[model samples]
Target: MSEKRIIVTGASSGIGEAVARQAVARGWQVLAVARRAERLEALAAEIGCETFAADLTQEDAVAALAEAAATFRPTGLVQVAGGAKGAAPLGETTIEDWRWMFESNVIATKRVIDALLPLLRRSTAAPQQDGSASYAEIMVVTSIAATVSYQGGSGYNAAKSAEKQLIDVLRLELFGEPIRVMEVAPGMVWTEEFSLVRFGGDQAKADAVYKDVQDPLSADDVARVMTDILALPGHVSVDETIIKPVAQTHPWMVHKGPLVAKG
Candidate 1:
């Protein structure tokens, strides 16, 4: 639907899915990428968008993810596919699980950007003062966990923090260029799939995650904000925006008094 081309990683669910849906609504041509082909296909169909199925954890897939942007000549990039492998208590956490979190989230993201940079660069070569766009921009969904962590999130937190730093370096390096990079961190949004993905299909436990917070941010809420950020004029580049639901305050705090009591 968009006149401009865009690529969204982790397009299967969560913030990535939300961003893609929002982009399509604004008439942007969307390339939804994710490990889950079924979900991506359904999303693509529903939004009249394109899709690519790749685990992104595999080296070959990461390579494909980066280069895939070249084929589409996307003007936008959204990296949202990421997860915490296991939530074992700190001492019980294994290197293997930690690696899973880092590789899938950090390493894969780097590889894809490495491959896609050339294309993104091409799109933004000449800063667009003209109506036609010559450069592209990217939006990456990070977690509040990157800055702080839950008791069992030692590994996941580190991985996101590392990713965030990498992008910070990229921004400094790309200051003169039109290829913009941004990060959005959401504290807690009701992605429906969030707990399912986090707890790995434990319906009861997943449901309990939000039992206290009555006004969780719906996926639509995040999608709307992200869409607004992207729709901003190109002259302005948003480095990162951190957001959290009112029910959830900070990493170490929770304000679940009561919805009726909440202002």
Candidate 2:
């Protein structure tokens, strides 16, 4: 039996999927959660981790997920099932898009955390001889957009920023507990669906986001960081980390083409 059990959201694709794969490789009992049953099933068959399908934004779905997860007694929660719906300026963005953004990014995160926190607490591992206990963890995958604002990114920026703030406060609220709250804010990840979905399925526009950029961050790159952090002793908490490609200094400050030495 695996020593640790972790709940990874967004396991249907992208970063969450990558994290689940790596966690399983490290001998973790992973409850891979996502909305798509097929993808989660495929992952489970290939990697031998369990899967749960749920749309976290729905109250009934989250309640159901929490009840199911309680059976496994998860020691960790990884919130990564979030996205950007549109790339319009604040005035041009529709209220529908804004609502979706908040619901998917911020509200979904809150719902999952609220419902599953008790399970995490109950599953805390025994303290080791090194004076460190294997504490429960809550790791969120925020974005660099959470901290940096750009034109036409108002909705995503606000929603992600709010999500980051929620994680920040959660760390404070759980100060005396053995629960560790953390977040990884990545910049310019070249995921297959992120930009495409943000641009509303415009392939060309999504392609343009990474056009000529040399080696943008990949899902595996971010996942490596997340898993490595989780592997650390429970006494050590990374708290917060921001990851980005060298070509991406900020949302608007991406440098296309190769990086050459300046004379």
Candidate 3:
């Protein structure tokens, strides 16, 4: 079978990094995109995959990323470059925080998709080794907050909800095209940076968020689901997958145990 290439955004760390590594391990070429040049270089050194350092939220950087990706002609794209900002109540949330959330999550996803459409279309025309239909896949990693609202989560929830809606509309618009749009909403993922960044680098607060959880999902756990969905036949499209650790029922519901900090 011919090699399959994929572009993974937010590949500097967490779920995006895991997806890039896992894809490379599965014999697929990966173009890792992130804002941290040092981190991307480290990942490329470790995994031997191409790396592009660019902030997707910037128009010029995203355009450059798309141009590089077009040359690679990746058959798949995984948009994982998004996060939550200040966890303030509706009235307390600053306009800047809300705008940042929307820009990072919704606007960035749309920009990357728009810039890569030509490459994605070209991928669709390539012949499949198995003689099956050729399909280019686009996966977005949204959060469970997209559907469920919680206290002090209005800004994040709104942003993620918009991203989800965008994916839904894209799927419907590209129904007959050889492109598959999928969304993965993960809950309670225990990544080192996610909570830390959300809490403004307050280690204590970040640690408290998952202190009592029996077993929280790791970045790789979420990436595994993405890889599995991508591995499916081109004719099969897993439209939306909501994945959570067994201890998590929803965004607000979680099974808490004794608080224990790992050294």
Task: Give the range of the ten consecutive residues with the poorest summed lDDT in model 2.
Answer: 125-134
Query: If ranked by TM-score, best first, what sequence of candidates would result?
Result: 2, 3, 1
Give every collision pair in model 1.
1-27, 1-28, 2-27, 2-28, 123-134, 123-135, 124-134, 124-135
Q: For model 3, which pairs clash?
A: none
Please give the range of 10 consecutive residues that has the lowest summed lDDT in model 3: 253-262
What CA root-mean-square deviation does each model show from the true structure? 2.4, 1.6, 3.4
lDDT tens digits by residue: candidate 2, 84-194: 988876888999889999999999999999999988888765664564565889999999899999999999999999999999999999989988899999999999999
Task: Arrange candidates by lDDT, descending.
Answer: 2, 3, 1
The runs of at least 3 residues in candidate 3 whose Cα sits more than 4 Å from the true structure, single-residue gaps closed, are 258-263
Question: Which candidate has the highest lDDT of all?
Answer: 2
Model 3, residue 91: what's the lDDT?
A: 94
| Pairs that collide, model 2 | none
Please provide, for model 1 over 114-219, each residue's C-alpha lDDT reduced to its tens digit, 9 standing for 90 to 100. Answer: 7777777777655455555565787788789888878877887898899898788888888888777898888877776767766768888777767777688887
TM-score per candidate, in order?
0.91, 0.96, 0.96
The CA lDDT at 24 in model 1 is 89
Model 3 Cα lDDT, one tens digit per residue, 1-263? 44678999999999999999999999899999999999999999999999999999999999899889978888889999999988877998899888989999999999999998789888878678877668888999999999999998999999999999999999999978999899999999999899898888999989998987988999999999999899887668999999998878878888798435669
